[model samples]
Target: MNIYKQIKSEILNASHIVITSHKSPDGDSVGSSLGLQRFIEKLGKSAVICHPDIAPEFLFWLDTSQILLMTDQPQEVTAAFQKTDLIFCLDYNGTDRIGPDMQALLESATCKKIMIDHHLNPQDFPNLAVSDTSASSTAQLIVELIEQSGHENLLDEHIGTPLYLGILTDTGSFRFPSVLPRTHELLAKLLAAGVKHHLVHEVLNDNNTASRLRLQGYAMSQKLVIMEDYHVSIISLSKEELEQYDYQKGDTDGLANQALSIKGMKAAIVFTERDGMMKISFRSKGEENPVNVLAAEHFDGGGHANAAGGMSKLSVADTLDKIIDLVPKYFPAQ
Candidate 1:
């Protein structure tokens, strides 16, 4: 059987199906999970969305109550994993991306596993996978999967909206190089299915809180630093700073990308200090530099060529120093 048939078979054979994504759920993660879960439900199986952590407030438009966060309900999520017979892992390439607790639980699961993701160098896990690094987002892959499974009619506004969110954000609003003609074709189908593209954009991008705006200003004014000689821009936010501004999960979503908006900048890294560690977002100019390799080799993180994420056990200051020290090696000053 083909890929669609295999996934459909898993859905039809299972009683309790658990859908999940990586930790720190983004548009692609949350949207793909919700979108795929709804589709799976249409197939007559009971489905649940489980994550290792919570999604950001910007995604509040989604009825996220359907999503069970391990951070908020650890036992309940563990119970969901316990009873799952078929697991659909969306948006993340590896189980490791979902945090240690979830990773261990996922590894111990006797259920069949399927991975749907659009990230580079997927690890050797999962019983089956639909891994395509060139795809705009896993949401795009979800759309294709739905259509290929002969359920294109289910791409109604309810499903179309979240799918649109995943595609819209993951492709950087269609500006990223991953956006292809086929991507547009899928988007056209979504629009035809009654997805208000403008509102989708507005809800995800423009739906910011006043505190978040103030926080952005403060980060830009106080924390942002430009290294002219190295063509790098860096931003660091401590947990203390985040609390002072009433930090939300999604507040720093696009901060690293915004850093790269500076002229002549070749790379950007946002170092957010949290839980006694540093959470880093890395972005690089795709012209020559590949942040995925850089992050993987140096920062203990990986994603796409231009955009990736990593973590550091060192202090925030040291993490910043280490990243700054490595920039010249990747893009040496000539």
Candidate 2:
């Protein structure tokens, strides 16, 4: 169904629109939401972003005042769903990704739902879905929507910045295999639209706090365990360890990738105790060495082949042991 054309049509016809993403708002989630909002404004309409939770502190620089967090204001979020005529689900495929509260509101709403994402196995909830696993990010799809829907003339710095940020982060700063020539071509357009690429990199990367560095150091030096036999690295941090560093969300954002950088390491798994449960993040290199298998089958989560997320109700030590025990079965020694 001409995805670009239909989405444009829906936006033009709808009076009130609400945008949504997954619970844990990452760069892709925030960027896609903001980028699409700007695009809708360019179309002479408006949208309010309703996320299940707040974004990490690192992304607070973007203009996110329009976002209504369900964690902060559930009544307002419910009202938005009740009044909106259209909904745009970005980044994630399933309603389950937006947490139980937002999921129920989305399910009960009779609004026309449109999903634009770059993930595996999109759900059948949306009236229109644009799921392209190969697209670097959902933000990239926002740009595609603009260009393909005959709205390329509307893309400017305000719109391009967030879309560029989404592609940059989701592609691991252009290092991930998902990036292709088309991705770079879109990047060039963003740059030409005055996105100031270097400024974005500096803002995103150079804002790390000292406490974050200290926590990462402690994790890498003390908690890290390398299983040379299976070529996997594991880092598990208990709630106490996190508190010792005055931990904030996203403090361990790249810890798994750092562990995976070790020589001969096929995959890296990090477990952090937060919110009374163990949150798991998996990172790996190469398609043949997917971490999503373990994330989905064992960890109660799933995502892209190279990166995925899951959670464990088990204690940190037990969760670490469980992952170690499962490594042999899913990623046997080479």
Candidate 3:
């Protein structure tokens, strides 16, 4: 499908546009949304980037303070949605990730809906969907879209920085298995477009607060449970512990990678209890196990093979027990 043509046609004709990403906004979601917003602005169109939750502080370095943070259906956002001629959903394919109110707005809006994502198993909701799971990040896909749409010259410093940030974080600083030669090539282009690499690096790596560090120490020292026999590692953090540590969202970044540090570990799981639900994150080293498929089939979540996530309605203890009971089935001793 000619994704570039479709996107260009929609943008050229539409006046009011709303761009959104998934809940618990991550680097890729914010980066892609902000980058796309700037790109649309360059085309002489006004666009609003909205997310259901506030992003990590480090992400603010992307200069997304101007972007709208929609915790609920605000009157301004709702008004924009009502009059929007087009809506672009980035990073996530399904509206389930964008939360209920935004999902309802998109479903009910008369606007032309477009999806630009890099996740597996996309839903058939958008009028034009561009989903390539092989892409390292949705920002990378947006870069390709801009190039194909003949908007390469429109990518100024503002657009370049966020796209670079998205690509960098999503690929784990270009250390993940998804990093391709083309990914580097795109990074080089973004750099040429005046993206500040050092700023982005600092934002992603050096901005961890003291509270987050303390929380990490607690998680690693007390919460981590390693089951070498099962090649499974589990880390569970309760709301009480988080409150004690004064933890904020994104404070637990890379907490799951601590399990991968153990030798012979096949899979690592991190469970964070919040608002009565267990938020689970799964990580794997090699292709020995398919974490994303496991998350989708067994858990109510899906992502890439090496890293995926799911949430359980069960309590943290029950969720851990369920994962423990299921791990042996997937990783049995030969």
Number of colliding residue pairs in each model? 0, 0, 0
lDDT of 2 by residue, 64-158 (tens): 66789999989999999999999999999999999999999999998899999988988899999999999999999999999899988888999
Look at candidate 2 and tell me the lDDT of residue 126. 94
Judged by TM-score, which candidate is best?
2
Tens digits of per-residue lDDT for model 1 on 31-114? 888888878877777898889988888887888877888888999889999999989889888778898998988999998999
Tens digits of per-residue lDDT for model 3, 247-319: 7888987888877778888788998988788888999877877788778877899999989999888877888
Q: After superposition, how far is residue 85 of candidate 3 from its true place, in Å?
A: 0.6
| TM-score list, all predictions | 0.96, 0.99, 0.96
- The segments of candidate 1 whose C-alpha lies over 4 angstroms from its true place after superposition are none
lDDT of 2: 0.93
Candidate 1 residue 74 Cα shift, in angstroms, is 2.0
What TM-score number comes out for model 2? 0.99
Q: Candidate 3 at residue 95, lDDT?
A: 82
| lDDT at 30, model 1 | 86
Question: Which residues of candidate 3, in runs, are more than 4 Å off?
Answer: none
The stretch of ten residues in a row with the least summed lDDT in candidate 2 is 58-67
Candidate 3: count the clashes.
0
